[model samples]
Target: MHLIAIDWGTSSLRGALLDGKGHVLEERSHSRGILTVPAGGFPGLFEELFGDWMRLTGSFCLISGMAGSKQGWVEAPYCPCPSGRVEVANAIVEIEPGRIAIVPGLSDVHDGVPDVMRGEEVQIFGAMSLVGLSDGLFVLPGTHSKWVTVKRGRVTGFRTFMTGEFYALLSQHSILAHTLDAQAPLDEVAFLEGVTQADNGQGLLHNAFGVRTLGLFERMPAGELASYLSGLLIGEELRTQSIHGGDLVLIGSPALTQRYQLALEVSGNTARTLGAEATWAGLHALSAIHIANKARS
Candidate 1:
C-alpha cells in the first residue's frame, strides 16, 4: 500500500507520497504548520497541502510532530520511553476512518525532570535503522538540540538543550547583539577558537561576556562573532553532555549538522551525519507496524 507521510511541525509542514518500499514518488512542503493553522482548520489545511495526492483511495496517511500535540488535529498522548515501532504504532490515532493516523511522541522523566518530544522520535528511530545500529548516542540538532540514547533497538533515555534558542536570543536581543554580524560567512578558525575557549571552565555567563570584550579589542572581527558564539554554545552542550570517545550519529539538515560534527571532533569524539531523509524512513517504519496490526485485527 502507498503511504502519505506528513511531518507537520510548529512553523512548517512536509508531506511525501511514498511507494510501498518507502521511496518518495512525490513530495510537497508548505509553511503551514500547526501554529499557522486557524482554529478547526486542520483538515482544510491538510487537504490544501495534500489534496492532489489524497485523490488516491485506500492510501494510509501517517502524521508526526506538533500536529499531534494538544493544539493539533488531535491530541495523541505520549508513549513512555524504551519504546519501539510497535509501541508508537499502537499509539496512532484514527483521525479518519481507516484513512489517516497521527503518530504519538515519546515522554520520559530524567533526573526527576519531566521531558517530552513530539516529532524527533521518528527521526531518531529512522537514523538507527538506516545505520543498522542497535545501540549508540544520537544527536539531533535544532532549535532544541536532543541528546538521545538508544539501547537494544529502543530509545531508553534522552535530554534536550536550548542551544539554538539561546543563541538567537543572545545574538538578537542580549548584550552580544552589537558584537555579532548575522550575515557573515562562518570563520572556521574563529569558531574553533570559541570552542577551545569554552573549555576554560569560566562558566557560560562569564564566557558570553568575553565575546563583547574580544570584539571590542579587535581580537576577532565582529563579522565572525556569530560563528564564535555558535561554537561557544554548541561547545558548552558537548562539554556537559557528550561522552568523550565514540561514534556519534548526528541527524538534521547538512548545514546544521556540519557545525555539530566539527564541535564533536574538537571535543575528541567521532561523528557521522544522517540527513532529513531519516524522518520519512522512521514514519514508514511506524506505518508498516500499523499495517501489520490492522491485518491481525
Candidate 2:
C-alpha cells in the first residue's frame, strides 16, 4: 500500500507520497507547522494539505514530529527507549482507525535525567536503513542537536545538546554578535581553526569568550568569526560524546552537516550524512511495520 509520510514540526510541515517500496513519488512542504494551526484546526488543516493525495493513492497517512506532541493534532504518548518501528507502531495514536495515525516519539534517560525526541528518531531509523546497519552512532544536527546510540535497530539511549540554539544566542544576542555575520557562508580555514581550539584542554566557556577577543584584538576578521564560533560549539558537542563502533551517521541539512563533517574529520573520525528524505523513508518503514502487525492479528 502507498504511504503518506508527514513530518509536521514546530515551524514547518512537509509531506511525501511514497509508493509501496517507500520511494517518494511527490513531495509538499509549507510553513503551516503545528504552532500555526488553531487548537481545533489540525484535522481540517491536514485534510486541506493532503486530501487529494490520500484520495488519489489510497494511502495510509503516518504523521510524525511535533504533530504528535502535546500541542499537535493529538498527543501520542512517548514510547520508551529501546524502541524500534514495531514498538513505535504499536504505540501509535490512531486518528482514524487504520487510515491515519501519529507516530509516537522516543524517550530515554541519561545520567538520571530524562530525554525525549520527536522527529529525530524517525531520521535515525531511516539513516540506519539507508546505510544497512542495525547498530551505530548517529547525530542529528539542528537547533537542538541530538547524539543518539542505537543497538541492533533499537534506540538504546541518546543525548541532546543545544548547540545550534546556543550559536544563535551567541551570534545574535551576545557580545560575539557585534563582530560576527550570522549569514556569512562557511569559511573552512576559520572554521577548522575554531575546531582545533575547541579540542584544546580549555573548556567551552573559555573557548567561547575567545570569539569576542579574537575580534576585539583584531586577530580574526569579523566576517569569519561566525564560522569560528560555530566550530567551537559543534566541537564542544563532539568532545562530550562517547562514540562507539560503526559509521558515525550525520543526518540533517547539507549546510549544517558539512560543518559537522569538517569537525568530525578534524577529530580523526569520518561521517556519513543523509538529508530530509530520511524522514520519508522512516515513516514509510513504520507504515510497513503497522501493516505487518495488522496482518498477523
Q: Cα deviation of 160 in candidate 1 (Å)? A: 0.3
Model 1 agreement with the true structure over 97-209: per-residue lDDT tens digits: 67889999999897789888988999987887889887889999999999988888888988889998998899999888988897788888788878888899997888899
lDDT of each: 0.87, 0.89
C-alpha lDDT of candidate 2 relative to the true structure? 0.89
List, residue by residue over 208-249, the lDDT tens digit for candidate 2: 999989989999988899989998999898888776546789
Could you tell me which 10 consecutive residues in candidate 1 have the lowest summed lDDT?
Answer: 239-248
Error in Å for residue 25 of model 2: 0.7
Q: Give the clash total for candidate 1.
A: 0
Candidate 1 — what's its lDDT? 0.87
- Compare the candidates by TM-score and give the number of the best one: 1
- Write down the TM-score for model 2: 0.96
lDDT of 2 at 282: 88
- What's each prediction's TM-score? 0.97, 0.96
